[model samples]
Target: MMKRLAMVFVGLMLIVGNAWAVPDGIWKNITGAPAYSFYMQTYVGNAMLVIVAPNTETFWVFLDADDNYTNGFSASQDLSGAPNSLSITFTSDGSALANMTLTGQLPATYNLSRNAQAPSTGDSGDAPTLISPADGETIAVPTSASPYSMTWTAVTGAEGYIVQICTDNSCTNVISDDNGDWTSTGTSISLTHATAGFDFYWRVRADLGGGSYSPWSEIRRFHVSSS
Candidate 1:
């Protein structure tokens, strides 16, 4: 009788373990992001998942290649619904996932391959703010100085910045500024190449370590009084 009890206990433990397993694998998006798609990706240890919304603005978390909905790697089966689209929050370095609502449409059945390509760049982080020379401020060009300095607040996770100064507000006409399209480790840069006495538009974007970049800060317009 004790032997039989022991056997049952072992079986129960196996069942519980299987029930609480987190799938550790790579899941690819069979369907490319739609033109109207809003997709998000999260990295959980060895597992990487992408959440995509192809049809509506409302977003959903990852749907495994086997058509199983991964509830943010949690062992929970409950899914929450909300009117607004869902987004995934991640820990620094893009490891460990969180803040998933788990309420979105499951994609049609698709095959998910295990342990594919490693996670590439484009991880999430807070955006950097632009500062200095104040927005829309006009600085008189020094009589004989060849360059003017621009500055911005440093971003915590950013390793460098891509600065663009344009002749137009839209940044289409790239101004001949320092090392045009230069990536700077410091917050400030001096532009010796741009033409003086013309109104110019400038913006900066943070390079979040890896190839990921924060959205460009609001464009600031500066005027160069003729020397």
Candidate 2:
């Protein structure tokens, strides 16, 4: 039997305009895996790419914007001819609107689509409630191959979330996040640590951008067993 592999790729481009800078790029409709349709404006310079895969979860990589025509930008990858490693490249000069060009086993590619506008500052809503470990339960330590699955309820109108794991109830010693910030785009995240066998306190908040965030949720406690 052949092994199954799944992957999703998204890119964003930001250009300096007028008195401010504008962000544009490929935005994937979060309609699960095995099927995908993206939205974007003309493909220019300064691109951001987000990759999602099993176990690894969500990751974002960016290419800086260049205003000088002489300074061109580029990115490269070697998929090693994997089933999903279909090489593709697209570009636009911004002289006119352009659509995405996909070359691979991708489901559908849009050639005359409109820009997928970014969300503006909206309601911050309420704090996200912690859902795993049962608030005082003990769980096995997470390994590099497998990690504790931290999860929580989604907040209304939330663009993202800030998660904090600590050693004490006061949260004086902060635990490092392996998966970056658990972005609100996804409700669950994998958690891991080099050393375990410790008690951990955690809390979460809603990020509304522009220096605004929802109040932190009530802290929850959990213990990572040594065995």
Candidate 3:
């Protein structure tokens, strides 16, 4: 039997323009392994690529544009701390090709076709409820102490949760955000980079997979005071 390998490759590309040749949405593999798919979305003036695979390690990379070009982009990074690289190209047509090279494996190409437009918003009722460090709550932090714990009520049928901490109530300035690897199945996470004497706003959303996410929970604020 052949070995089955799964992985999610997420790349953040900083580009200069509001237009893109490739549509932003979920792209399914038309040729090659049935497990390969890509989800592209534009966030905060950057393009984000999300590869969804089951029981796989997640890889993230930041790619800098090499030239003033549109319609296609490529990036190389180590997957799961392995010596592997991937290059993807998109065409004017609703199609894409991904070339991947993995250690001790033959190079392969996967053909992808546009599936659907990226989701704009998720169901509000599926949103997770914030639990810990309650709204307007004050927490004293010592110079040497464990990270602040942020907990929330889990949502049924949710594969994972995304926590975003911002500097404003409107969540325009996001300072910290974590998706918990999409398989953690945990309802809480620790904010290790929280600074003292500052107000932080946070919210939680459920990741329903297939490029769909639940609406963000109500914004909550907390204060971190120096001990």
Candidate 4:
């Protein structure tokens, strides 16, 4: 009886351990764009989720319980001022299906694949150089009549580039858009509208593919005039 009880205890422990297993690392959406991704991490026994939208808006969700993962996890948070909920189920170690819902919008589903390598900041020498809307230049508000163009010097081996516009000098508060993150295979991107009467900062980075990216270019600041 003693031996049988020990075996049962060991089996229960194994089941409990497997039940607590959660997916970690970066998972990118395979189905569509604007590209969406999630970065799952655990720190000090706390589970954290970072959601990246096509427009480069990042939403961080903190899970309340460690027991949230039972072959999958679910969470909800306010993202970009909208109430958003996310549910993910692991189909395999390398694949998952995510169901997301945002207030006032249709619920959407995504097929995800784990990146073989997580993205890390690459050498600054490989970063792109900002060209137009020169640092500190004030410009008329972007409009159809006066659309503003942003340009950057191309990197030699770059497959693409990412442009981020922010409202702060530090570039933490990125400007949000519905089209997706500003990614281009070319050197320039045009903007039709940006909030007028505010200072804006911009930067560029080269996308080298396979989860590799160059360090951001030196940030540049510009102001948009309401007139």
Clashes of each: 0, 2, 0, 4
**Stretches > 4 Å off in candidate 2:** 1-124, 178-184
lDDT of 1 at 63: 31
Give the worst 10-residue stretch by lDDT in candidate 1: 1-10
Candidate 1 structure quality by residue, lDDT tens digits, 1-106: 0010000110101111011112333333332322233323333333334443322111223333343334433222212222433322221222332223233343
Query: Local error of candidate 4 at 156, Å?
Result: 1.2
Q: List ranges where model 1 is wrong by over 4 Å.
A: 1-123, 142-146, 176-178
Tens digits of lDDT, candidate 4, 1-227: 00111001101011110112223445555555332333344333444433434223222222223323223434453222245554443343323333333322334554555554444321223779898899999988898787889999989778888898998888888875568678889999888888888889999988777544566899999989977
Q: Tell me, by lDDT, which candidate is best.
A: 4
Ranking by lDDT: 4, 3, 2, 1
> TM-scores across all candidates?
0.47, 0.43, 0.46, 0.49
Clashing pairs in 4: 54-180, 54-181, 55-180, 55-181
* Model with the higher lDDT, candidate 1 or 3: 3
Model 1 per-residue lDDT at 94: 26
Superposed Cα deviation of residue 204, candidate 3 (Å): 0.6
Candidate 2 residue 55 Cα shift, in angstroms, is 33
Q: How close is candidate 2 to the true structure, as a TM-score?
A: 0.43
Mind sharing the TM-score for model 1?
0.47
Q: Indicate the TM-score of model 3.
A: 0.46
TM-score-sorted candidate list, best first: 4, 1, 3, 2
10 residues in a row with least lDDT, candidate 2? 53-62
